[model samples]
Target: MTHILMIPGSLRAASSSRATARALAARLPQGTTCTTADPGVLPHYNADVTDDAEVAAFIEEVRKAHGVIFVTPEYNYSVPGVLKNAIDWASRPAYESVFKGKPCLVVTTSGGALGGVRAQAHLKYILNGMLAVIYPCKEIIVTMANTKVEDGILKDDTVLDFAEEALAGFVATCG
Candidate 1:
């Protein structure tokens, strides 16, 4: 079975990013398994500390997954602090972390028109620095995301279909 780990960049239970991730997870093909990681459960990043069980588990999730999907929302023109904290935790050993060569697909959502494009760019750059193999595909930006998601799931068919298609292509590369 192909396992895909999804990380949402918001801690709010009703955030559009989490809703989008949930929707994507539910729509994956029969053979693919989707697991969502909660970055909120992790503590702030600190280089001085080591041997954090939560951090270790988070890294292991990335190491074991066939690919990763980041669903994030823009906060003040950048990725949220909570998400960055999780990334920092898993980004140990510099260029040789679990993210090294790990396939990643990015999807961004926003309440505004830009759809978290800036945050997406920032995230891709960070992932590139970690040597993660970013999936080559059109950017998936869900604008007016606040209206597109409901009840903890993405409700926009157009956005969801496009994302699902992108995911299919991404999964093909995972093997």
Candidate 2:
């Protein structure tokens, strides 16, 4: 069974990005499993503090996963600090990190018209820096995202279909 590590970019209560992430996980194939990681719990990145238990655990999760999906909401046209910090921590040992050779997909959601595409691009660049095998599909952006999620459920079939298609590509990439 394929194991996917999902990392949502926001710490906001009832965040639409988180909801979209949950929906994507549910849309995966039956044999696959999705585990959400809490980037918010990671401390600020520093070379001197890279060996903590939490950091070790995060690295292990990524190492064990078959693929990773970063569900992000744009913050000032780029990734949120929490997500960036986590990436910084994981991107150590210079091309020898767990992210190396792992497939990664970036999905962005936002209330704005751009649907966090800028952030998605930024994340893709970051993933490239780690030598992660980036999924070849185009960016998946959930725009006007507030309308797509309600009560923690992704209610729009159109958006869900789009997400499912994106997941299919990601799954193929993972294989």
Best by TM-score: 1
Evaluated at residue 47, the lDDT of candidate 2 is 93
> What's the TM-score of every candidate structure?
0.97, 0.96
**Model 2: how far residue 85 lies from native, Å:** 0.4
Cα RMSD, each candidate: 0.9, 1.1
Model 2: colliding residue pairs: none
lDDT for every model? 0.90, 0.88
TM-score (C-alpha) between model 2 and the true structure: 0.96
Candidate 1 residues lying further than 4 Å off, grouped into runs, are none
For 1-175, candidate 2 gives per-residue lDDT tens digits of 8899999999988899998888888898777888999998888898988468998899889989999999989999999999999998889888998889999998999988889999998999989999999986766888999887878866778877877887877877775
> What tens digits encode model 1's per-residue C-alpha lDDT throughout 34-102?
888989989889887788888888999999999999999999999999999999988988999999999
> For model 2, how many clashes?
0
